[model samples]
Target chain A: MESTQATNHVSYLQHKPHKIGILNWILSTDHKRIGLLYLYSIMVFFIVAAFLGLLMRIEKFAPGETIMDAQTYNGVFTVHGIIMIFIIVIPGLAAVFGNFFLPILIGAKDVAFPKLNLFSWYIYIAGAILALISQFASGGAPDTGWTFYVPYSADSSTNVIWALTAAFILGFSSILTGLNFIVTIHRLRAPGMSWFRMPLFPWSIYATSWIQVLATPIVGITLLMVIAERTLNIGFFDPALGGDPILFQHLFWIYSHPAVYIMILPAMGVVTEIFPTFSQKPIFGYSAIALSSVAIAAVGYFVWGHHMFTTGISYWSRWFFSFLTFIVAVPSAIKVFNWISTMYGGSIDLKPPLLWAIGFIFLFMIGGLTGLVLGALATNVHVHDTTFVVAHFHYIIFGGMGFAFFAGLHYWFPKMFGKMYNIKLANISFIITFIGFNVLYFPLFIIGLQGMPRRYFDYFPEYQYGHVISTIGAFILIIGIFIMLFNFFRGARKGEIAPANPWKGVTLDWQIESPPTLLNFDEIPVITEKPYTFKKEEEA
Target chain B: MEDKKHHISSFNSLLMVLIGLFIMTGISVMITEIHFSTFSVGVALLLASIKGYLVLTYFMHLKYDEPIFRIMVFLILLLFAIVIGITFIDYLLR
Candidate 1:
């Protein structure tokens, strides 16, 4: 269905630059370059956070203050949470892969606004710098945690205001990127590419952009209010100053809850794309998988009140929120089931990407099921502030979204760089990461059920056994992470040359050169069929 | 896209909008001073909302923008209003 004109000569990497060296990359308006830039920067932050997490686990290995004091432990965990939530996962797949592939997947050359896309990276870097400064700028590292829950945040001697401001700026960065994607998706589809004809990855990005645009402002305003509370003595959240703390919780979760969707939706998009490609079948239910992302994004907003359940909200509000939270699982389950159905009776390749995708489904199911337990008013009371909540979120965010990120990276690595990493090493790393991840987190559930609290430097002797196992597991997980990073880094420099369509996928991105040129298409592709149809070869 | 001439409010109309906003603010303050204590918040919110509406419609040119932009904005407002309504349910019940 595609009609090609005279092709562009240069691949994107070979495209000439106006500036030399680092400036060429930094100033480049190519979405692919910017995507790689985001990938590199985000990986650095992820590594930092991972190391901090390892330290936390190390200190937890024996008992009280194994390596650091309580205050230091608190600060480390808080910074880890900030880096992971704000810097790594919030932007996550959509920022990295979405920027790289959204336009190409939809048969467009570039996002609607390339300048804004580059500006967003700069803004992200600026926000990262400001956030780093917040930790070291004042009395000490901010101990308020990433949520910046007030009273403590307001009263804390640390530079909470700077953290708040940094978060505010980062929110702007997120909003701009979201806005760019939304407009690009809306306005830049090539000729004859209808809404349903678009790939699921772009579809999920569309849904995610809406969440980023709509929900991020609430957190931005809330963080600013905390800044105001600290500086202007605004009595908004500090109970000592006649402010209601629950209100702060309300505002915080209002954005942060939906923010979870911002993290997971693009990852869900990745899984949807991977399922059809690896399974060698059209998706079992295209509309269901595509619309489920939107459905998840929509229902995700109303469930924020679930986070405040143990914080003494009223019975009716708590029950209402609990019910709403339960309702969200239906759409999530639909997507998960459809992914499995797509693989049924198909020629499954069992590639590393597909393995990670399957891994995501397993971990996300556990995460989502445990979420129901936390969503219930009765069980929430029992698990609140315990390692239970910590384990539950890690299962979802790290296990589900993190796994999906790896899957997308492996799936699209060839497309991004025109080379393939070692498949054997990739598979090995996935297995190790998966095994270590479960090992590290599973014991937390056991000990948490027995009443171990999270964010503590010390634990009872009874809990020490669990912590010891978990620390060992953490070491395994870190080794896996390092191996995975090493595999990618080594493969990028030296790997097999990948074909244009390595997976024999039917999406628009596969129709192009492996390392696509600076302008994606020579002649803008004219599309006529649904994105995932595998019937092109015989017909052509 | 930017070259498309959206409907622009005249200087006279913008001035009128500003004046209306000022009068609403003044009337809102007056109502609070006159001890409409129960409706004070309601009145202030109403007036502030009007000023916000005027600014958005004229200054931000939503009045001239496409239907999709209007729908996006209306949806955002609806989301906020729904959350506020839910909050009120808990507070009023308490």
Candidate 2:
């Protein structure tokens, strides 16, 4: 603390000049360090899950039990979904970049409860470890899928209890982080930084944290009930004991649907920041874009029932859910248009970060439109559990949220590490990843409509071409990811020294030193102007 | 000063909220005494909302807090109501 003692010039990378080393990271409460900690940990899980996904794709390449057995294939995708959903993507953006940039953006030193922030990371790791342990627990890995649906989960011989309990604990980690962000945003903005004047990223985070706080608990309770049913022979979801399976689904999705927003809203926030910063213009319709995050979160809850339309819900319920699902498109579409408008006629800087953000918009629009397809009662019945649904989810979760995470990572890389990555290589990686992603998922849309079902170890000869194409795309995509990560690692060590405000932006973060000091601002910045004031300064 | 005005501190207000909660609890039990099965759940929920309102207002100081806080709490409750109501639309329609 002494070495970092309120110096204006020292970046956070130089905190504790002569003190305890890794303990400063694992045990420290600094928000910047906590964000990097999440970055390192989540990336490790991302690679692991990506490999799992590749294996699943390989098995599907030529159908007919290529390598793994049906049971192993089932277990692989389940664990893959668990690791990707619970460990990596769900908490990815908010935990990593949000933790890193939020305090600096708001002109605060750290989160309101700094120690609680560190505690949540530990909880996340503990839950992740438990999920790994569940893979080897009694009766092998869980095959109930990430949704962990009804009587099967209750009666399965696989380690459903461990998986559910791990998910339940992971919910706590998410809740605490959400609670921390909400409080920090509410109570910690620096002098003169009113709500509307706050940057779009933090505004979206404010929305995400609310969903995390309110929606995560529902999944926690539902998972606990699943554990209770598995262990105690309770008939909560089992038809043998006269319980309705539909209720379990309702409870699961009530949280899971909102949990989807928790995944994407921060990603949208990252895109919001990236667009203007890259385009060298003030954000278009800033207020509408900021409020739409809240609108998406608000509308997210009412439409969970859409996921259940094919499950024999009543006719009226289906219609109600279908209408609400389409309604979510409005706010989401507004954000897409706003991002494009931000880019229009501006001094467009097509950096790696901006490219990824642009990529996110294109991919996410496809995902959202496909989602409306699946939301309708008519089309949903045609592709309910097919590879089409799988492709749709990946495009949204992997393509949308995942690319946005990469965009944030690239955008903040210099600011984060105080080093500039190889720009040429970064651009090349983005193009390949974009092409590979489209090649990987677009074929599934065709085959899925042709009715090739998902989660099977082997497929029919008819679906082989699509499977082969998707598998080849995954490899190319993985290769691009490798080069991008290599550039980041190489940049961190021996790359060009980055100056403060590399992007030449007007956010409070750019006002401070790059790789910001132990406490974010040496002198807490006064918000003299609205955020994203590009060509002109506001009257203070 | 503006925030100070938004917050409540009077012992009288707290005591009055306590009395209202007690009355709501009585009504909640008395409503069960009326014994129409369908109406019982609705009546109990209405009384409970009143009790919850008292707790949130005086006991928890939401009434004293900013309008933003009130809006947030209302939004949360409204979300839950939509979820529950829309979920039941299926079985109710069937």
Candidate 3:
């Protein structure tokens, strides 16, 4: 395997542009640097949101006003949801991993529009700052849940406008990043690396980019409508002002639901890359996995109505959405089956990345299956606003996407930083995090099923047992997260240097130096084979 | 460096498209004056979509571009139509 020193390649980290110091990172247009900028920024936001989440869990320990008052609890969860959804997970995998690796995986020098890519990160920061301002500005943090549902959002006296504007700006950033990825993938693939020959990560990014471009505008316009309603009293969603509140729901979910696919497809793509490398086998049903990403994105658009089942949408609309929801699950299940099959009968490495991938499947299955329970018209009405929905969402987003992010980070950490992390520590952190995650969320399912409503600061005494257990689980999860982060930090500073292909993978990324040089390849090599051709390696 | 020739619309062709867009806008305004009751919003959307089509075809050069661009545009329009059509299912039933 090749090493960066062996190739005399200057890593993107070492290469400095015209700008010196911090400006080199914040001002540079190199995709890798921009990706690290996103990674660092997202980590900051994730910690903030996770802390807010921990506060919420602690408050739930004994129910009524354990740590904070009702209003404060509302503000905490609202900000938590906003930070996690818009700032972290939605852009998490794609912005951080996709920007860093997409060009390398596809054998390109950089994304087609590097400057626009940097601009997206700046817009993201501006939006994030606005969100922070919303929290501490004149009025208290907007109590409107991250959904910022109608009538209440329109009437709320809090700094709702700032939050809405922040979301709108963030959505715009998402759209631009998506646009850049689409063009890069379309125009810049290596000579012989056709669509089919491209790896799953880029394919997933391609699908996610399309969703970001197409679906995000709907949310942007919808949020602006909310802003207009709040500021100008435009009567877009206020029923008293002759606006239909349900219309707001329709527009919001039109984008937000597809936005879910935008979050998960790349996660699915990340695990797909990991399974093949660790298992030392070609990905099973390569075309199926690739096409499933697009299929999920396409089908994801029409199923937004499932969210409105109890919003009193028409029966036929509910039925249509319910049916489409079930259909969307099919493509997701296909990807899962293919991943497991990829690992079947192969030389499994059982590395930390693989452990996270396997954990993703376990957690995502729970999230996905419970999603069907929520999708069914009969069952959805029962748990519409219950803690059950909360559990399901966390299992999917936090358990699924969050775990997949860790998997990709561990898998590519060496390649990205040219340093290998502590393998034993990495594995231990995954175990703690996995167990803690399940413990934190699992009880919510039980209590949610028992009729405990979500978003309330206080709950009945009967639900106390579940909340206490869940809060304990929250602490455990946080400990695991810190350990994993510390391990990465320590490894980056003082660990053994990584080989170019530590896992003996056949993908183009592994074929390059550990930390790739500026403009990636010395010369663009023509690819003439499938992306994951590990048969030769297996024979050897 | 490049082999594919860029398609530049003729001056007359561009002017004709501009006139057509203006006429459509005028019709859109005129249609609003005579309300079709429940069909009013539908009529307005139809007119707006026609204007959008003209802009995309002539101004955006989708008409002269490769088939893939046109196909992608068509698919997007179809998706938008489906979303709107599905939303109406609730209102119409209610």
Error of 1 at A539 (Å): 3.5
Tens digits of lDDT, candidate 1, B1-94? 6667667679999999889988988887777667665465566677888888999899899989889889989998998888767765766665
Label model 1 with its docking quality class.
medium
| Native A-B interface contacts kept, per candidate | 0.29, 0.88, 0.82
Model 1 CA lDDT for position A240: 80
What's model 2's interface RMSD, roughly to a tenth of an angstrom? 1.0
Model with the higher DockQ, candidate 2 or 3: 3
Per-residue lDDT over B55-92 for candidate 2, one digit per residue giving the tens place of the 0 to 100 score: 88778888767798899899888877777776766667
lDDT, candidate 1, A1-540, per-residue tens: 452322455778877676577877898989999999999999999988999999999999997778899998988998999889998999989889999999998888899999999999999999988888978875788888888987899898887787788888889989999999999999999989899888999999999999899989988988988888888987888888867888889889989999999999999999999999998899988899888888999899898999988777788999899999999999999998999999999889999999999999999999999999899989988998899889999999999999999999999999899889999999999999999999999999889989999888988899998999899999999999899989998888999888888998878888888788889888888888888787756785
Top candidate on DockQ is 3
Each model's DockQ score: 0.54, 0.64, 0.80
What TM-score does model 3 achieve against the real structure? 0.97
How much lDDT does candidate 3 score? 0.92
- For residue A109, give model 2's deviation from the true position in Å: 1.2
